[model samples]
Target: MFSRLIRAALLAATPLSVSAAPVPANDAQRGLAALQAMDARVAAVGERLAVRGAPLCGDRQMRSGLLVHGLAQYAPAARADAAALFGLGDAPAVLAVVPGSGADRAGLQAGDAIIAVEGDDVATATAPQGAARFDAVQRVEDRIEAGLADGALSLTIRRDGRERAVRVTGDEGCASRFQMIPATRLNASAGPYVSVTSAIVEFVASDDELALVLAHELSHNILKHGARLDRQGTSRGLLRAFGKNPGRIRATEDEADRMALYLMARAGYDIAVAPAFWDRFGRRTGFGMFSDRTHSGRRDRMALAVREIALIRAQQARGEAPTPDFAGR
Candidate 1:
């Protein structure tokens, strides 16, 4: 007993491992994390948006397996080697498989590389030199979308050097497309497509809040905010180059928020959490600044969200279709 006690004491006296966990991330790790998070969020938000936004936007044709690729526009390093990108995710990988999605049900996983769609090779049938990382991948997606235009799609995904054919039935929904980009700025943009920064995706507290952001961005597309700004002669390059024209930007923001209230409501997302998100998000370290040159004040944003919600609620109570007031834009 004495000998055991002495050994235990000495063992306890030894220094613990100097771990680097819970420390600052190097640039590479930070970049990888941002990209990975973006892909994961892409899978998640894409699934959610397809389900909710499709019904609201009136796309309702049928479902594409929630299969995400690693070589999308934002993360191109995956094209370097099949394995390297696969390590980050699957090479040209299946980044995420949404729960209960067609992909999920079809037995696809995160580390599967879609080698071929139908009979054609996914990335030129083999990797090419000096090609844009996402070129062939884009072609594969395009082919799948087109093939699905009239019917189903069949894919052969290679995992661990083994290939298995998976058939996907594509359902058409909203016209808006979704993309994930690795950016630190809390910025998301919408056109025919809605692209959200990985930062905003990781920052939001819940999917509901994320939907709020996406809904607002989608509103920009729904109202053609960028095109309208152009029509109004608001210089886009100058506005972005130097934070000029607060009034025009503020008007667009107000319009987006107003339309978002109705859009998100129709999509069955909780607009109530929106006020709370705007309340906390704007006060963050890199956010919530009182910028007169770009966005409106926090007070104005908060008030606008609340006002829109009230108006929507009143409209709902009156048994009237809550039409978005995008008049005179």
Candidate 2:
């Protein structure tokens, strides 16, 4: 979340050249540290979920288990400061490498700059002239995805100012990418990407609670709710809250909630935390009440989680695999 403290820090920490002055203990430095810490936590949790929930995802893909960020992701006003402090370049660079992941096994390290993917020159891509530009990063990701789809994926990484080829035979995992956005909103969303704001990450009490959030978003993607809503002719604007659209949206949310518990259980997280976390989130954020017209109320969501948890626990007790109940399944 972009807190007042962080915003104030960002303002105080204006962009400067690398040769300007020795890096001081400023708000920018502190903010960068905080952001990197969040990145690490999100990458670790996301990698675990991707691996553990792969069976549920059904259609697995080759995943490198790397979290990347570039200078372009920073505000234009803060890019120089960020680059000076973090040694980040315009090319997509590794921010975190999941432990025991393909990237880790391939000897990839944080700060490694990816110049090319599968022999394609990704570094040559034009750098966008603004803050929060992800075109370059997404280009590299597209290349990697295309390469992996064909067969093995290879990367040319620049580390210690030396470029070398790294052959990456990635692990099979869910197709979705996990991302942590810098925002003040305590919210998350899913389509091809499962994104959680820094606010929600900070709000979660523990990894178990965080798993509840991630699993829910992951379920939405696995269920293809966004695409399904389009197929159902659901509106994306204010009309979404009117007529039958709210019911249709709420149906998907309910399905995702139910599927989320199973995902948590499959990932070996404590399913018992689901109900309490949703209740607390609902009360604290008013997320399921008042202005929220497309979601079940706090009470209904909590009740559904409780019921699903019971089923999951029963299956666990009987030495059976916990699974979600799809329609007619």
Q: What is the C-alpha RMSD of each candidate to the true structure, in Å?
A: 12.9, 5.5
Cα lDDT for residue 228, model 1? 78
How do the residues 60-97 of candidate 1 rate in per-residue lDDT, one tens digit apiece? Answer: 43456444444332323433332343332323556555
Candidate 1 stretches greater than 4 Å from native: 1-38, 55-67, 70-91, 123-133, 239-246, 285-292, 315-323
208 in model 2: Cα distance from truth in Å?
1.3
Report, for all candidates in order, the number of backbone clashes: 8, 4
Candidate 2: list runs displaced more than 4 Å: 1-25, 126-128, 287-290
lDDT of 1 at 153: 71
Residues 1-329, model 2: lDDT tens digits: 11111111121111112242225467877677676666667777777887788888866788877766667656777777766665666677776677677777888877677888877776745253654566556566677777877546799999889999998777777788776777777888776667777788899998888888888888877887778889999985668778888898888889988988887887788888877887888899774333647888888999999998888889999998887767711
RMSD of 1: 12.9
**Local distance difference test scores for all models:** 0.58, 0.72
- What TM-score would each prediction reach against the true structure? 0.72, 0.88
